[model samples]
Target chain A: MVPAADNQTRSENETKWQLGMLLSRPFFSIGRAVIRWINILGAATVFLFLALVKVFRSKQLSKIVQQLYYIGARSTTIIMLVSVFTGMVLGLQSYHALVKFGAQGAVGTLVALSLIRELGPVLTAIMITARAGSAITAEIGIQRISEQIDALHTMRIDPLRHIISPRVTAAIISFPILTTVFDLIGMIGGYISGVMLLGLNSGVYFHSIQANVEMKDISDGLIKAIVFAVIVATVCCYQGYFAHMRRDSHGAQAVGLATTSAVVISCVLILVSDYVVTSLLI
Target chain B: MNTPLIKFKDVTKSFGDRTVLERVNLEIYEGEVTTIIGLSGAGKSVLLKLIIGLLKPDEGTILLRGKPVSKMKKKEINAAFAQMSYMFQGNALFDSLTVYENIALPLLETTNLKKSEIDRRVMARIEQTELTDAVKKFPSELSGGMQKRAALARALITDPKIVLFDEPTTGQDPVRKNAILSMIAQYHRKFGFTAILVSHEIPDVYFISNRVLALYERTIVFQGTPEELEDFDHPFKDEVIHSLEALQKELTGLYSKRQFKVLNHAQMRRRAFGDTYCIAVFTLEDINSIIRYLGHDAVQEAIRRMGLYIDKHFGVIGGFSTRRNTNEIVTVLPYSDITEAENILKYFVKDFQGLEINDIWTGVRRRVAMAGPVEFTILAGIAQGQPIAEIDSVIDSAKSHQKEIWTATMRRRGEKI
Candidate 1:
């Protein structure tokens, strides 16, 4: 009878433990995810710092120029294509909506302000993220897996100095210029739709753009572009530079996963930081 | 004793929950080719990385010339690392860079050398590596062997005091493998740098290594000369060395000479005291002439075909074959006397002689056709022996009885001359 009683108690204890563990499992998973994200954030921050510090190293200018050609110059056509369509769509939509209020002449103010203050930087960032950001991640990931980075280390060449710094610098410089170009081209697109197609007065369109678009609006867009540049470059480079450390994959598969993650994380961060920056600036 | 150039003192390394190496202690002296051998993922590469500071040990001290690396200042650590270079297993030549640019990158990045000086150094290394014609070509454009040579040139461009080669001959054919090892040995002698190589090319690597360090079970199990390693009885020898020899046999379709001896011993142990076995040494005569007339690739093809034929004929009757050198194949027939061995050899010779040129020249036919006809002879020598102790004498006797058994010379007209 005593032995039966002990077994019953043991079963009850096991049931309680199991129930408790089941109830706490989600919390444990959440906590683990939180810790993992925090670790990644910290590592990325350190990576960015190391790369930024080496921005002025010898022969860095040449590497930076090379990256500029890849990230900024090469991205112009795609950015221009996307921006023009976006501007035209905005022009068409805003014209219809403002026409209902008998304010169709204000279309130029709306188009210029929208492109310069919001769509230009955001869309430009996203476009570059798709084009050059993915490439950088893949290149660096391949280098990491193939031990090219380790080879650099053994040669006493700091990989951050040789690889990442030039890229970060180039992106920081490129983002602003590309954003400005995106603004100009998108404004022209808006002009094409508003003045040429919709028959709004060309004079009114040009005058409204000149009068309503403030220096503050332009600067805000540039600031956003620069911030997005940092986010995109840091996240992409970090993911790829440490692709070999991924627990879920290895080798070429790890590189592919890193590239995907880099693009996804960079896009998400750009949107989140866009909101934060817009709110702070406003 | 002289101070070791690099020393790992009770070092431990781990990744998350898995410990790859624990409390590992080893010493590599200056100017010695110390090869670290182990199975895949046995921390041989981790050891090399630890020395070069590509990865640091989680615990314990790594001393360079008696100075603990972990205790050194940042600048001092950099200074120590600057004296070393690594040749990665994959060659790791920058895919975007041309051969000249790849080899020149180290000098351009690390040193403040003038452009002309860098060009001169790069050109010299390119010529030395026999990559002069490939100067403008990217790594992807170069062949595997050429890429390895480019990587070696880059590693040696700095004239580093210490060099680490991580499986330098991993994915190479037997000829290229030996060529790379010989190149490493030659450069080691010329540069007199401390070299730590991670490899599984047993016996081959042993021939070039001054000190052999065997890593097994996360720690170095043996450290001694290659001769000492042969006599040193350990699980590492049985597991890693013997298994790699087995892999070597699979890759080349022939046993190494050491593996042949091991098999001979095992066969003798299985047999009665007075049981007679036969040793036949088949030599591909006038190998230099064949090489000269038909090119190196054709010669290699012929040898490979010969090995395949030997296996096909002798392997059925429990006979094993090994390539004694570049031109000779030694077959050991267990429980067979001279008469049986001769009979088998006659059949093999006749079959081999009647083989179409297409059979032996499948891959190299175009090259062979361009080079025209070449005459080559197969010579076979046989001797019977009872005692395992007299196996060497038996082999010597077999070599002495070598006589031409078959000859073939192909003409462009599809007729044998």
Candidate 2:
């Protein structure tokens, strides 16, 4: 009341703050809902798998096993080859550095520990995500656009259980197994480079690797693999699933948007979950 | 009668509140050719998607087989998918797969059939679409018409009870469009499946579609037979009838259409040359280039061969013609208008050797006669009365301005001026 301009300014400020709250609440609510949906789907997929394992036999088991085979067995050769080269490169680099300090024997410790506890699991998770994520995303997206997903819901088939569950569980099973295989091949590579190629005694090489790394390190690698698996599979499935769910009249843009979001969300979640898993465990 | 296959009740679909289908109530029955006609974006495709479960109504329910789609379970929905197959707007054949593989996917994945039987059925479908040659070809490798046929083959692979065609004639040449439509009609006849097609193409009314549904403004504006829509006595009809009537008229008088077109072309050509007088006539009668069942490029070569000597003398240019009606076209030299006489006549050719004329379809052949100042330029001799033939007779007979001989059509005086 002291001045007309001052009163208008105060009212404008109040309106802006109120509008911000209005926008913020809905935005945060949707984001939180999406995250909760993803978690529920993840846990639900695990439960469904357990339930299916009890009831399914013979043909069903073979089908699910065949799916897992397609996901994992097909991936093993590339995973092993890449891991061996990664370890060999690490051994070579670390050997040169350690020898400068007259600690060439520590090459085993560096390669084994680094590959197992970090590169092996993370790299494997990334590769499989790229390979399988696009396939799942595109399939789910097309399904959404085509009304197959709605048809499932109408028929009392839970799309999450039938489609998402199988994919996510398959990814979860595949990644850790693939990572373990990577670790073994990576250890062999470290041995070849350190003991045979770099002239460290085979005995000292094994001893240093054993002494420096513990069960905790292997467990850390396994844990990282599990987390990365869940993140990639869940985020990708969620993105694909939600992107496909939009009932926009313009179907092409929606399908394209779904594909892009699936890849981006899977990649970001992998990175974010990587940091969280590392910080909590370390 | 049996319960309707699909029922939409007050189903309002919107994209972010911009409602496309507003409170639309419709019922689709079994084994009927329901052709939906409207302007593009009248939400015809959206309505098809809604009925097929591709989209959900924001306001109401879609009932299929007497059950609300919203309440149905997933297995039931998958079962429904078996009963219906959708041919998308672009004939969404999987470009990555061969025609055989694309058709085989749904059969192999969804049905409990042996691979051998699936192959047999897929082959049978390819043969039925007259696409036996395209079985191993990827979708992108095929021509536009062939791609649509392949998609139709895939749609039929399931032997679905209901087939949805989204714009079956959107991009095909007229001859190819008819070829696909005939195949669709054949499938409808042989299989007795419900054929609901969403299209904006003008209907071939004489063919007698069982029902025509038009989406206008935001609701089902007209629902009737093709004959009923053309009656012009209907109540509550959206006002696009005059244009529709004109299209119907053009479709019937395709002969006159081609002749008038050539006359128009001659007019434009004469204008282009400023004062250089030349008569020309052509039919938008798209021949070899488009009428592939008429024998590929062989028909075009035959037409060219008839005028090979004349083309050299006239600096003649001819290719595909602009189609107001997509039947046939003959160019007057530098054509598209109908002002010139000599240019039109000299350039006209009605009956080329080897260019077979379908009496009713290729229209009555005609010749155009135009007298030019430079040594009686006997451009083309077309037979009189028939669209292209009359113009050819005009070229042969009209030797001199004094021997104007026979002015066949009074329209030729109109054609002359």
Candidate 3:
């Protein structure tokens, strides 16, 4: 079979230019692309399981330890910083609003409720986007263009298994613990503000925080945070994975574009997801 | 053919009305280094992409180890890519990662290998490609040859069963070219992988890859052993051999003068001192086929198209255009040296060469001459410095010399003086 040489050339030319827009399009429907998304999701799930199997088979405790540090131990600073700031802001806003009705003491319970219900999870989501999201997106995007993804495929190793799954699982596991820490720190900020800044009783502040935040609220916030974590991680991985699909195959700019796009998308998605979770809970 | 490891059966792909690949069938056996050789835009790269599952065949099937590529998921298809290594013409290394990181990336992503194990394996590959010194540097920091080596290191890091080299010798100096070829040969030896190389570096690639597939006229015009290609005995084979000989002659005679023997009185102005003249055609590889393909019409079209493309893009062309005929235009550049003429010819000739025809029917091709995608190739030929006052014999000499080289089936190297 022979194709017309000129026609073949022309088609190749068109494909090269359209490559960017075509590759980028998956970002739009991939989440909602039902069958495609499900296929990818199911495969991703299987890939994760396979990786876990390999890890167990190989007895790779060191890799697991390194991942624990990368996902959990190293993220503490940003996590703590986000929670404290969210706490202080919640304290200041609640002070003015509750005091206007001569109910300034409710600031303790209000801060706890806000942090457990929304602020802790939402702030953690934003922080992780800046921290974990950027690292994962950039790393994978570099791999995508560098053909490391292709290299993995050559080695008969599903890149989704060792590369994407670990990060995704790490995010899911880490975000809840991170959100719990944020929730605890945020309440402490409320307690400090109430005791020192507002001259409220420390006993009352701590008691209010402890009683106001229930297991259900904590559980719900943790669940939402975990979901947001998965979204951010997966979106970044997807961006990086599909980066090579571009014909022009952007170099550094592609990585940057993907990371920025992932961040923006993840941030927006986190907010939308937050609303949905809050509504369902109420 | 012993149950080919890979086979392309009537595979055709089109983008809208323009077709990239058409019902193309090819069989690649295991353990053979098959080189696909062709000119730029000949769809060699597209073929590689199709086999790697980067693109799908719109018409037929690509079987790998008896499985269809079109039916595989990206992961499954991508899994096949694990069995292969592809070297891009651009040496598309990750700009952000250090060389070590680039080599270690596949292991980190795909294998359950520990960091130390990945590092150890990467170090071995780096050593294999002699990129240990460059391990810490990014792709930008390395020299062109070193970057190529690093890219090769990255490709071979995972020990793929098949490797694809895309214009591997392009942009490389002769030394670097040979080194890369031998490096590829070495990897092919150690891994026993089937190497599918895409390149125009025939003299170099022909040594390593036993089988050659020449993509000409959208068909496999030449597919055989190097001996078969040398003795191809077909008109097309003659063209290739003639081309190689001509190119070699062109390069070696760069500084040598061409003695022209003026035959008739009409060519009198071209000589000096007597009925003899001499001029050196330093660069012809870039412009010779072009002249043959389009004739004089191509030259004028090149000049005009160059002017238009320059206005649409960026480039400066100021010279004289001699209207030899309605279709043939010869420009005798003044004030500019021979090199400048080469540069000028490179830019304006594509439109004249019929290469730009694709741009008209399909809006997909990047006019790299305009897009800054690549710098244009430039070459120059120098005319003898004999004064026009005694020029008859000089014109005769130059003309005769040109005739001799043009008529000779093979290049005559030692006929000087």
Model 3 lDDT per residue over B15-89, tens place: 778786676778888999998876677689888877776667788899998888767787876667767877777
Write down the DockQ of candidate 3.
0.17
Candidate 3 overall lDDT versus native = 0.64
Model 1 clash pairs?
none
Candidate 2 chain B: worst-modelled 10 consecutive residues by lDDT: B368-377
Error of 3 at A33 (Å): 10
Q: Per-candidate DockQ versus the true complex? A: 0.66, 0.11, 0.17
Q: Ranking by lDDT, best first?
A: 1, 3, 2
Q: lDDT per residue, candidate 2, A26-120, as tens digits?
A: 88999998998787677646654553453332223443566588668888888888888887788889989999999988888898899888898
Cα distance off (Å), candidate 2, residue B193:
1.1
TM-score of predicted model 3? 0.61
lDDT by residue (tens digit), candidate 1, B233-344? 8888888888888888876787877878888999998988778999999888976666545544456666767777786679999999887766778899997988988888
Instruction: Please give, for residues B1-417, the per-residue lDDT of candidate 2 as tens digits.
Output: 679788888899998759899988777788888887766778998988787776778998888878888899988976776688788777766555688887776675566788799989988777666676777888778988777777777778877899888888778654455556655765687789998998644544224257888777788877767657655354424354445535543433222333334454465444533333233333323232222232222222223232332333334443222222122223333332234444344333333212322221122122111122111111222222222334444433322222221112212211221
Candidate number with greatest lDDT: 1
lDDT of 1 by residue, A1-282 (tens): 569989999999999999999999999999999999999899899999999999977889889999999999999999999988888888888899999999998999999999888889999999999999999999999999998898888877889999999999999999999999998888888888988899999999889999999999999999999999999999989989999999999999999999999999999999999999999999
Highest-DockQ candidate: 1
* All candidates: CA RMSD (Å): 6.3, 12.4, 17.1
